[model samples]
Target: MAFLPTSYEEMKQAGLDSVDFVYICGDAYVDHPSFGCAIITRTLEAFGYTCAILAQPDWNKDEEFLQFGEPRLGFLISAGNIDSMVNHYSVNRRRRDKDNYSDQGIMGKRPDRATIVYSQVVRRLFPHANILIGGIEASLRRLAHYDYWDDAVRRSILIDSQADLLMFGMGENTIIEVADALNSGMKIQDLVYIRGTAWKTKSLDSIFDDYIVLPSYEEVKTDKYAYAKSFMIQHENQDAIQSKMLIEPYDGWYVVVNQPPLPLSQEEMDFTYSLPYERTFHPKYTYIPAIEEVQFSITSNRGCFGNCAFCAITSHQGRIISTRSVESVVEEAKTITKMKNFKGYIHDIGGPSANFSRPACDKQREYGACAKRECLWPRKCPNMKVDHSHYVEMLDAVRELPGIKKVFIRSGIRYDYLMYDQDDTMFDRLVQYHVSGQLKVAPEHVSAEVLDKMGKPRKELYFKFVDKFYQKNKQFNKNQFLVPYLMSSHPGSTLKDAIELACYLKKIHHTPKQVQDFYPTPGTLATCMYYTEMDPRTKKPVYVAKTYHEKLEQRVLMQYSYPKNYALVKKALIKAGREDLIGNGPKCLIKTYPPRMVSKKKSSKKHIDK
Candidate 1:
């Protein structure tokens, strides 16, 4: 199979004077469906268009971006599979040492905020090209929102990037419409009515449809209450069928986002995956750490309805689940078996949530997700349809394939939804064949108050799931474990809450090796809470562990069993008035002596020796 051109020589060898689009990216050119740049380029090729890739162009020099030259149509830009800021820095805002998307996991290949930087560079060169930016960075920052890196509200990325249009969400269908419009001699300015897109305009006179004008950028920037109110409105209007156009005003121009694209149908999903994909990184690099996990994996579905507070899936992919047909997934599995390094195993056959292979309910699929409530949070909606029979059947089919020995589900599974399913067939199958000794599930926190803020189910639900998992393991005579994903320092989690979590961890005899601190990324409800110190949905005051020391203590509490964390954990326990946990009791988190006292005793002995 021939790969798309990424340099001038390759473009010429392919015998193309000028291509339909010049796709610029902040990631190495990996021609796999998992990467957004690859999908868009391949999809355009299938639809009678020529495209060349400019992956990870050097932002400081014009030569890197000029390699592919100006395109016949426009330039399509993405900040790779991950947001550039998140990839470059940690929650502590410390520069990260490795970039998985870069060649050899090296850092500094791409700039921080690569999308804006690349777009600005291209704009300077091309000046009049149709610049369209999308992917996680553009999608989440489509409107005026909070930027964690800047530590303040930022304008819409479209305005900053000076792009003609911004495609939000999974833009397979959206890109096709855009290409068709541009091909028919339509200017980017005239393509405003397209769904699943946001653009910057100077006037609201052309907006003839029903729309809601959000609080002006200035208002949300200054007033936390206005910011919360603005976020609540956007969250409610995320549905495709029932959503109206949303407009956000700036000083002179405005950012208008059209209703999201409808979720892909089964046939459409099949077609998208069926396109030609090299399914590996380009030959230029000997290694790319990002490919190791996904090289053998298959994305069976897209989109998520499990609207966790910290996740940005609802903002980017929306809350509707769209899955591929069983045949399509099986075909992809067959392809995997024939690859150069074929193994008898399929690493994963999953998506956002493995078991969520269908919509939450018939009403959600036909009408739209309910604006007032989440499908599985605060309690599963009465109308929610909880079943796993089809998922079980698909897994059975995949595992039974010719060269497949095992098909594992590695994506996060919604334990609450799994428990809600009446049929134990999928649950039985999961325990029987799917799990790899341990299944990972996210039970972000144990305290009810913190879980409510995180939109996770009650701790009681997690305990129930744990008991049922072990019961199934015993029934099948297998020794399996449940590795619960824990989070620390999320909004509404205080010192007392952290101590309670530590006590729960002590009771369970499981201390997580790695605990994630809450990162205030854009377009997430939890981020809003972290910044505003209030639940945007209810407008109620919420506590946030904003101080560095408090965040450190919370993280230490989760991993309190480690020898190095003794001092911090002891300090946290004492500060929370839970000094009872410091002594050597059966349920105590740490030993009696603080590390400081031990150090002081050692120092005294050294002084006497001197």
Candidate 2:
């Protein structure tokens, strides 16, 4: 029930000679379910496995890794909640100045590619130890991936990390099975049969399931087309029910990934969140910046069905939605009310996609998500269930809880999904109760081609949603604002496309405060397109904004109202042959000249002397 032992003294104090797993992490230890390490470690403890927390340890030497001596079952490694490469660097591939996961928002707390670095160090120290790597870093990079940092295709993290086993996706059940098997005296090398795991083997002779072999490491590394094909195959097989075992070939070894594990049942989800989490950072640290946001928040669900191209939720959490029971969420809210600093507000009560509280359709429960189609992209599938009644009921219950003043859905709302639902009761309640003055939604791009490439709904759909939102606000007699999250420089976004998006914004008289530049991280359809300049599904050519200058221009166009971006906006407009926009017209993005320059041109010698 106490914090997991982070040192040998704590281990002795807990009367354990050795732990079943040494959970080495890149982030500072925070015992919250929001942190994957906490959930995994807590689940292990619930099942009677001892775990030692080795968080943000010195990777420059192996001595720090020796502190735990050796875990009895294995060394469980994770780069915390965020991928280490992403944690260390930004979308522009620059080293970040701050790390929220670190103590006191410090930087350089964890090494670059922390999972690989920590695993390699542990392997050197404990050559024969069982090394298991999971979390976002290992999960997304479990296969041949185009790493943006290296700008090259890299083999599975299972191979590079020298780990004995790699677990992907939500590992609650997978870890327990692996722990029980390891506890039952199964070797790490023999863990290939477990679902949601990928392992490196010298030979594929032991494989028994019907599996597909992906292109070799050499092939994907050298051939972009082959890489795109391989990525699409991987993307399609993400569902648990329909996915097959995937084998990726290397020179002397093959990495075989078993089909995804079945989605957690509602009871399992409730139990997972009900675990006795300290719900804060360890006592040793005064503050962990990551904890503040989630400390009072409740996660009511897991997984996402939206499955946007730029997001890795599908690859990491899978497409099927797994939700905690309403009673479970309400209980968590009650606990939050009892906290010493209990504010009346509950920060969030949603997961990856807030509106998704069940499977996309009943078919998903039986056959898994349609590999070739999406639930709410291009168009909502006819068979998909479009109801938010249960979600509204759940929220109603939470907001009614004693000591709870307001519950906000800050995670995100899929406006298209909301608009598709015939019943607007959820929308009504959201406007009346949950709007903390502003509701934020993602309308990533306005251009049809760019929207298609991002797997987002059409701009027309967003416009309809916008009108509906404002209409509802008017009906409620509330003056609420809709903050649309727009992204720039995504794959397939040419200069013209960006300009079109800017024009759409101009029509609304709204300038986005921030524009998310397309980040080509690993294991995403968009990232594949960014690397190959081709859509994996159709194999059609796609435009990618690769250069920093061009990407900046696109970003500037999104915020064209700012005077600092005038030069770049003008350049982009002229290059795209929108020179007519240079004049001082109502629809123009930028003027032909700055006020200072124009004033100087009109100034006379006499006016200057005066």
Please, what is the whole-model Cα lDDT of each candidate in the order they appear? 0.89, 0.90
Please give the lDDT score for candidate 2: 0.90
Q: State the lDDT of candidate 2 residue by residue for 1-610, as single tens digits.
A: 6999998888899998888899999999999999999999999999999999999999986777898898899999999898888888888889899999999999998989999999999999999999999999999999999999998899899999999999999999999999999999988877778999999888877777799999999999999999998998999999999999999999899999999888999999999999999999999997899977798899988889999999999999999999988899889988889989878899998999998999999989888999998888778899989888779989999999889999989999988888988998999999999988888889888888999999998888888888888888889998888877888999999999999988888777777666789888888899999999999989999989999998998999988877778888888888999998788899887777853433233332110000
329-351 per-residue lDDT for model 1 (tens digits): 88998899999897888888888
Q: Candidate 1 has which clashing residue pairs, if any? A: none
| Reference-based lDDT, residue 385, model 1 | 90
Error of 2 at 204 (Å): 1.7
